[model samples]
Target: MRVLTILLCLLLTGTPARAVQPDEVLPDAALEQRARDISAELRCLVCQNESIDDSDAPLARDLRLLVRERLVAGDGDREVTDFIVARYGEFVLLRPVFGLHTALLWLGPVIVLAFGAVALVRGARRRRQEAGTPALTPEEKARLDAILGQD
Candidate 1:
């Protein structure tokens, strides 16, 4: 039982294996680290949600190679990222930059939440108004009392 528990813990805590191939590693450690960093920020177009560094897709591999190639050719981190963004139209970034064009993306949820809260408040007030009982006139009250007395 102890062995089973230990094995289960080990399996659960194990680090995820990177998808980078042996041949794709750069000869320079600095360049390789930079390449790794850049790949980590890039989303795999084929896999949709997975980072290029963690995706095993062919397009992910190609993008990894492109980052390394750009790094080797003396391009800075920003330059490599910009080049890729230009080609892929910003969808390739794991986290997109906020700008005027992406204002809706950033503020849409807040706007929806505000509208929902207002509607909820209005609905509650409306229900309260509708639930109130109207006051009976003196004549109606007398009639009701007379009917009860007859019963």
Candidate 2:
């Protein structure tokens, strides 16, 4: 049983998944650096939370290649980004532009936090008001006293 468990664990954990090959790397260090920089800022559309540089998706590799190609073609960083934005809207950027279209993306978290603070303050105030109210009538107080007296 122990050998079977070990075999199962090895089967699950030991196999190496396919990743990008070393031969696919760019020969130019400067282009490679530019690719890395651009990839770091670009969101991987397939893996929404990860940057293109860190994502293993084929689309991420394509984006990396695109950035490198643009850099090699004498385009500046902004030009490369502009090209991508033109192709895939502003949503592809990790830090979206500030405009009517993207204002909510920039402000959504702040608005939620402000609302939460207001709600929390109101709740605490309500609790305090309830706590400060008179505890009991004379009869209720007498019953409470009697109950305590027994203890």
TM-score of each prediction: 0.80, 0.69
Clash count for each candidate, listed in order shown: 0, 0
lDDT of 2 by residue, 1-151 (tens): 9999999999988854423346546788877777678878898889877888777899977887787788889999999999998998887999888999878888999999999999999999999998896869988888988989953
Q: What TM-score would you give candidate 2 relative to the actual structure?
A: 0.69
Off by over 4 Å in 1: 1-7, 137-151
Q: Name the lDDT of candidate 2.
A: 0.82
User: lDDT of all predictions, in order shown?
Assistant: 0.95, 0.82
- The digit string of per-residue lDDT tens for model 1 on 80-112 reads 999999999888999889999888988999999
Task: Judge candidate 2 at residue 149 and give its lDDT.
Answer: 95
Residue 12 in model 2: lDDT: 88
* Model 1 deviation from the true structure expressed as Cα RMSD, one decimal place: 4.7
